[model samples]
Target: MLLPAASTVFFTQVFAGTPGGVSPEQAAATMVAMMAHGAVGAALGATVRLSFDRASGWLRQLRVTPVPQTSVVAVDVAVGMLLTLPPLVVVALTGRFLTGVRLAPGEWAGLVGVLWLGSAVFVALGLLLGWALEERAAGGAVGIVGTVLAALGGLWVPVELFPSGLRAVAHGLPSYWYAEAGHAAAAGRLPPAAAVAALTAFVPAFGALAAVVARRRSLPAVAG
Candidate 1:
């Protein structure tokens, strides 16, 4: 997470100081990328926790509960949300200190909200991967794949740097969408109402998918 955020801050400052100044829109875009990076980090942390639980047989014990299997995914998402703050603060401060990025007080609040919302999407995706794989080794594999995709998706580097074809593919990924929303909020181009709507739709959609995956995985296989 710091990797992506630091890269964004460094590049933004570098570009802003060059012949072409970094516009507010561009600065917001960089923030959005950094926020997505933080979200991915949160997801990775959750994956690690789930992997540990599986390896230690803790997940098997948790499975004995009367609570729905979806509860596992919910717990993971909750933990991910809790884990998001430190990295969020680091990225925000890095941008502010290094790039001298400033936002109105209201915009600052909005940016934080956007970051949380984006984190929800990544957390849900992590939960889905954990439930779908149902093994520690599989979870580790998925985590590695996720990290690579994040880099390819421009979470570490701006999509603007990608070739036109790869950039188009990257745009279809959730990280890109989250980054766009964050950029809009940070840049003040997104209205509060619109920002709320985007997050409202994204969080529930991903959450539901995670719940479904968890429930399906919990069911015992039937003999043919």
Candidate 2:
């Protein structure tokens, strides 16, 4: 509900500045942001779901299984990634049909890459939040933080419309780069090689942080 509303509102605003309406590029970019935001929501929800199950002793009831804890996390990530695809396709197709948005082959490929990379980042961030906080706290925190970041990161609106200082701060977040990469792809412009490198770096950096947090929590507690 929020995703479609955000995309529609964004397109309407962008179109307001044009003679007729938004260009295909603007529409494509908005679609990419909408899809990516949906993926982020799935990833966050999956992480919280898994965390709740773990905290509730579901894992222990399975007995001493051969599956590693990390493998369990991997399964959660895979499930979240898979769950995101349908919504992405639905949003993309709907945007194209309703708004006459079109993407070239190269632009489409770039858009897909952005969605994958963006999903990876959000999944890692979700894992980190889940491992670092209690289940209830983690879910609430992720929901609130994700909503604000999505709004301020230009996923819900163009950053250019934001105040200068706020926009500058937004640029420091990973979401900003993800949105920028999508926009570049939608415009049929090749993103800088550096942007790809930065995204690659962020994946492992956050994933490792989440792994470390999860590992620490898995350890036996010391008597205070």
Candidate 3:
């Protein structure tokens, strides 16, 4: 989430003027990218933690309540959004003060919304990981998946920094779209509406998968 270390190399890279004549404005874009990545990464962690509860038979207990499984899922998705905010605040403040970044109020709000909404995509992924993997394995999965997604999606570095083929592949990931939405907000514009729309589309896609997995996970317990 872009922690501050006034003398550290990481700090220098982000706050120092961008190399190769990249402008401050351009460099500032990472603020949004970091926000999206940090939020989604944290959401993944939360999902893993919650999954342990499910694995331990916490969620299956709800089967008697007559709540549509989708409703339970909706709640998890909302919780993921809530989880994104606090870390986002820390990241925003750190990026602002540590880097001396400035943006309009609207821009700040836009980026926050973009990251918050985009997080649902990862949260849904967390659901799949949670249900699919063993409880202990899900813990490791969060780290592995976060690292891979970050590197491939421009969450760790700018997509422009990639070679052509890699960048093409990155474009296909939902993480890239999330980063794009955040970067566009940082640049004081709306991310492509299509990208935002696509993020919305993923909620249902990922959510449905999670729902299916979650149901399967519930089956043995219900049958008993």
TM-score of each: 0.75, 0.83, 0.85
Which candidate model has the greater TM-score, 1 or 3? Answer: 3
Q: List ranges where model 1 is wrong by over 4 Å.
A: 16-25, 65-72, 134-143, 191-209, 216-224
Better of 1 and 3 by lDDT: 3
Error (Å) of candidate 3 at residue 202 is 1.8
* C-alpha lDDT (0 to 100) for residue 165 of candidate 3: 100
Instruction: Report clash pairs, candidate 1.
Output: none
**How many backbone clashes are present in model 1?**
0
**lDDT tens digits, residue span 1-224, model 3:** 44312222254364455556434574466666667767877888877665676666657777668888668766877777788787677777766776666888888888787788778888888878877777778888898998888889887677888999999989888889988888787788878887888788887898788767766664234333
User: Which candidate has the highest TM-score of all?
Assistant: 3
The C-alpha stretches of model 2 lying farther than 4 A from their native spots are 13-19, 61-63, 218-224
Clashing residue pair totals per candidate (backbone < 3 A): 0, 0, 0
Which clashing pairs does model 3 show? Answer: none
